[model samples]
Target: MDKELKQLDNTFRKLPQYPTKVIQFGEGNFLRAFIDWQIQQMNKQGLFQGGVAVVQPIDRGMTKVLDEQDDLYTTLLEGKLNGQKVQDHEIIESINETIRPYEDYQSYLDLAKNDDIQFIFSNTTEAGIAFDENDNLTDQPQNSYPGKLTALLYERFKLGKKGFQIIPCELINHNGNTLKEIVLKYAQLWDLGQDFVDWINQENDFYATLVDRIVPGYPKERAADLEKEWNYHDRLIVKAEPFLIFVIEGDKKLEKLLPLKEAGLNVVVTDDMQPYRNRKVSLLNGPHTTMSPIARLAGIDTVGQVMKDPDFYKFINDEMYQEIIPTVALPEQELNDYAEGVKERFENPYVNHELSSIALNSISKFQARLLPTFKRYFAKEKKLPLRITLALASYLKIYAGKADFAPEDTPEVLAEFKELRQKDNYVQATLADEKLWGEDLTQFPGLIDLVKQDLQIIDQQGSRKAVQMINEKED
Candidate 1:
């Protein structure tokens, strides 16, 4: 067996450190596998001469372990690349060092002073950008991500330095705009004066970015076998799918700052990322959420298997092409191309995306990913979309214990399900639960009856048989 690997030990050649040109906020698997890996590729091509300094946004994080390994880690890229199974692995040497902001606040602010630092990237989770009024400006490192950012921006504004191009890759919609609003709120709450606000508004450019990549991260189950093959005992060996798409809503001139397009990366630096965002959320995410419960009930496990199965495949495509695409606002050809790409991504040979994993908090996921499309499809067609409604029925069935599918929801949600199961008018009652769907879904005419009918069919037949019936009815 190979020895445990650390940085710059004679086992591997030492890499020359470039100037820290990007200050990143999250050192987690997603950023490391996606963003840092992209930077490593650009640096290898000699197109980008920079390094990333990852800061641990929260106190309890992986910075200590990262620092122990000298910030070096391996990324295993495995998935179908252009219809061929490919597995590529490389040691990512892009991170210069990691910093814990809570311990060394001044050092964190000092990053803003670096002349070469032109970009700031972050993926601090969806809830990370929230405004925390309890966080004061004087508190070391501040409490929230935006609070720390506002403090750092005020420091840089005081020094009269050039502003950094900020792009937050948080999963929320319009993440950069939301973060900017919170930072402005913090500036006002902290009484940092109007000049700092102006500097923040005029100097820095915060771009809303949508990042897509499936980083399963740190294959614990296969680590020993993988370590034996690679002849290295790297702890941070992350696993990611081959598919990646980054859509950034930014000033076109700023593309020069992040010139990874030459490296053949699928980076769309567009002014309107909403359409791209819609395409991904609707076409990619919508189908995934809609298919999870139904697929699980059908005894299917992975997404690739769902695509390969004839009946499940037809059910997914019918939902996409008939209902989902009509709700999206994009060019016909463009949307069609994007849908095809999403299908390819779903069929990635190497990735085994479990339906149960996707089924976590599925009620909430349906509201965010599929509900808008469901409403829009009804509005345009003036009729309920059958497959989406059936998917809803499948979701309810899974939660109600009618199907053998296990669900992961809040106790409150499970309680509601239990109450609904006990009710005589369970279908109508559950459909009218405003707390679950934000608004009563029953307000849409024909929705209640259609869902009730689908539920009856699903109850009588199996999910796979119901899928066949859906396809036949669609045909």
Candidate 2:
């Protein structure tokens, strides 16, 4: 085994040397496959001369593996485009170095002071932002990523350096705003003075970004085949779908600086990301959240299988297009197109997208993703959206720890449901929990009773009967 600097594929030999101008906060497969892949395209087109310094946001990560490979890895993109099968592999060379925050804190902090590092990117997951009151300003590295970021920013400010443009790729809505708020809180907590706060408010730019791509990370199951395909063993090989969308909400100045359009990527920089956000949450994510538990309980395993099944497919297309899309504010044609794209994404043959995996945080998911449509539909029609409502009930029933037709359900949703079930009243137990729904869902007229009734029906008659009952009922 030749364990040395080698390009397993000839793809890396022609890449140009780019300046290290971006500080990325995650070494996960999604960032490598999605963002790095785009950066590679930019480099190839001579649109960007910037490289990325990858930093592991957590303790245990692939920093060592990336370092061993000299920050080189393969990205396997698999999916369909325009009804044609597509699968392509490319080697990414935009990553110049990798660093771990735990092992070398000063090195991570030093990146902040580097004038060349102009862009800050992060995908620290949904729960990344938090107020850690105990984090000290003088600590080698603050416990939270945001705290560490604040320290770095303060250091940069003290050194009379302009603030870097930050774009957090966290899954939460308005992630960059939330991160900026927390960073400001840390600044106030540590008594860093108003001067630093003013500098942060003026010099820094935090743009909220909505990123969409299905990166399944490492393909351990196909490692042997992948090794043969590339003629070398790669520990950091990432697999992702062909579809990618990056919606960045920022001013025109920042948009000019990014120049993502010049690279021919699906990147949108706009003053209002609300339309794109609505398109994603209502069209794609809402149906996903609605369909997952129902499909799982109906003996379907993966999203592709569900789309292929006549009953489930009709439910998605008809129920989603006819019922759900009507409730949204977008034009009918745009909604229909988005719905069709959603269906295609669901039916993507290369992805195994298990319904059970999407069942996590179903309660919050409903509140944030689907509840608005439900409310709007109810308000306009003066009746419940039966299929969407039924999906909600199915989610509650799924949460009640029923034996799913698929593999054993993860305990995340089941644990919360069990705790809610222990309460004296089911409606009070679940709907009144503001922490889950972000507000009292009980306030909605007839929602609590409807959910309770449908959940009871699901418990007694099973998923199929419950769905049939909803579908057959005359409102």
Candidate 3:
């Protein structure tokens, strides 16, 4: 049977009444299930009359599926919340329409001139913001999402329209602010004039947001059960955890703009989202970055498996609680609670987060996620952290692209590592790369020798032995 063409379940077919006031820049599952789902709730409660006009950020996305279903899709929220097993299902109907920017560039540009549009939401990922100097104002849809946004903002300014409140849900820190900065840089590069720049600076409300959700998106693995349960096949069915948090650093007026709190959501409007950001980065991202290479090399495939491994779990707790948490500036009890929550998130049995997937751009990740702890600890104790330094060494070795002691995984650190590996000076080549390490790692007392020694250990005895060696090493 062609189940996707069948009618949706009775509970999900009914559409909610709301006005289209938001132009979302990404139509992926995360935005659909998380953002749109919340909007659906708001519409149902009569707290919000706004709907989302989803814009396909890139050339390719779920626009076809969305268009096929009249911008309607089902989301399955399943997980433990507050010591209770919760499973809920709903079809999101807050998406008024979906547009492909490449095909209907004029239509997308025309959206900016709409006085009804007041909020812009996006989750274009970490690399979405960049200074693409070649992106002229006339391009159909600029190569980067931020570039397209710059053009849109300029159009809005030209029309003498009020600035829209922007809330970017990218995983990067200061995401909205960074995106605004890049857009301004593009405006300057194109010489869009001071008026437009001033409009962006003074009028536009760029609120940095911290979003938390374990949206796995599309349950391809559990298709049979899902199809049976829903009584229809949905290619775009998104699965997510029950927990969701959206912290926006903006004016309290946003409470009136987005009444998500009234609709029973964990949305927070604050003057600063720094504490929440720090908690997420230090507790969640920090452990993930440190554990990925170590776990992957330990023969564990998923984060669930790594959490199950006693050694890896202990390493995370010891490094995060005993070592990393102490260095962070937040209160001790709050940091401990965050660390506990992070451990639970890592141990999420439903998600099969691949360690190898997390290993991409690991060098840069270490600097962003883990280096703060490294710096803080060194300054406080005047000694290097052994486990973290070992993790760094493991990362460098993993980038050597080896699986069974010989080169196997594709190296994605940079071209220099590959070039240096060819010259039989892997350690020297890596340590000397000022761009990779920021400064020479050799300058950090015995860091180079320690890293080199750990690399050799990993090469000889494998990841498990290397971790054991570090665990046993006296500080």
Candidate 4:
């Protein structure tokens, strides 16, 4: 710790001047390490010639820190690559300026007049694209991300300028379309009229994008070691996984604007990103949701520990290949390859991904990540999926206060779980709750029985023994 004190006053490098062609919302770690780094890579390849002007979506954000350092930051990428451990680092120089809209509303509105700007990239989180009727067109700064964006678009429209290619990186199912819908709703609410609405609908193009990258953000434990290695002090330092893919549902025209693919980056501009989205949600997130509870109940903490455990590992691998893969519409080889990557990511040596972290809001996660595949399996086989139902049972067990870590969820959900814990037929009651799983899961052929059976095994044999038994029984 004393050795780290040697460079406490060291300065970070500054970015080069480039025309701000992109307006970025949310200057968080993921954006800096993924999108900004991609732009820097494109810039380095000379395939793209532009920089980003980050807009502060919320009143309180990292814009002050970003402005202090001339919007410069270092990104560190670490993970396994083809059975070999590797690390990559870059001083991301894609951000030319930062804007705090709350501080200077006029300056924020003036960004629309910048003719060089052609693209707007946003990752204002999943709930950021919501409609708030409280916001007005004449407000200094609007309440929601959609509201702020609407104000900007109206400004650009009144100036008679062409609209931007707005790409939304939110994790919602249809992020771009959702954002557009909310923006249009705001237009209607504020009485912005037909011509302004027409300008928004016709001139601008909103894209649904799936950005996959695990940015753990600011390696606090090893910051001193990193600072010692880099010989600089960067308060905005971000650590990211080596693997990332940006799947964008947009036109061929967007491909020409930002040549991220041309630079050999993992940017896929496709007519349909649903296949990729499904592949990711199922193969990647499904395993995460499934493994967390079972492993946590079995006294496991991190995902790396889960991978090391023979039973938990087998459960994940079997669940993905046997139950989850067939449900996704992607090609066989693609699914298998992605499954391999997900397993690798689960065992990333550098990250300690806590099962407790993934265990938050287990109900919603199970509904979104695993239920579709579970339903599909039921449709195809007319039988319950052994591995998936076990996962569901594991979720119920943990929520029933069978684990060391306290389960996290909405208060309403927690209260319901508390009530369900008192029921005699707990699994049946839980499955019949349509508000929990979106539909009565008990209606599925033999689902309730399967869950009850798994719950019995978990109760008697313990989570570890249950996992081992399930895999061994299948084999």
Which ten residues in a row are the worst by lDDT in model 1? Answer: 5-14
> Once model 2 is optimally superposed onto the true structure by TM-score, how far is the C-alpha of residue 416 displaced, in angstroms?
6.6
Please identify which of the two predictions, 1 or 3, would achieve the higher TM-score against the true structure: 3
* Superior by TM-score: candidate 2 or candidate 3: 3
For model 4, state the Cα shift of residue 256 in Å: 1.6
By TM-score: ranked, best first: 3, 2, 4, 1
- lDDT computed for candidate 1: 0.84
Model 3 stretches with alpha carbons more than 4 Å out: 1-12, 356-364, 403-443
Question: Which stretches of model 1 miss by more than 4 angstroms?
Answer: 1-14, 58-61, 82-85, 101-110, 125-129, 132-144, 158-160, 296-300, 331-334, 356-368, 389-442, 446-472
Provide C-alpha RMSD values for all models, in order. Answer: 4.4, 3.8, 3.4, 4.0
lDDT ranking of the models: 4, 1, 3, 2
> What C-alpha lDDT values do all the predictions have?
0.84, 0.78, 0.79, 0.84
Cα error, residue 254 of model 4, in Å, equals 1.1
Cα lDDT tens digits, model 2, 78-112, are: 89866678888887898988878788888887886
Give the C-alpha miss distance for residue 351 in model 2, angstroms.
Answer: 2.8
| Candidate 2 colliding pairs | none
- Candidate 2 at 259: error in angstroms? 2.3
The digit string of per-residue lDDT tens for model 3 on 1-475 reads 4545464533455655467899999988778877889988888888888888889987878898777776777888877788687787877788888878899898898897778888999987654655666788889989888899999999899999899999998777788888999998998888999999999989989999888886767777786677777677566788878888999998899898889998899999998898888778777878887888887777787777878987777777788876688888889998888788777877877766666656656676676678777878888888888778888888777667665433222233456677767767677668777767667766678787888888888888877887776666565
* TM-score winner between candidates 1 and 2: 2
State which candidate, 1 or 3, has the greater lDDT: 1
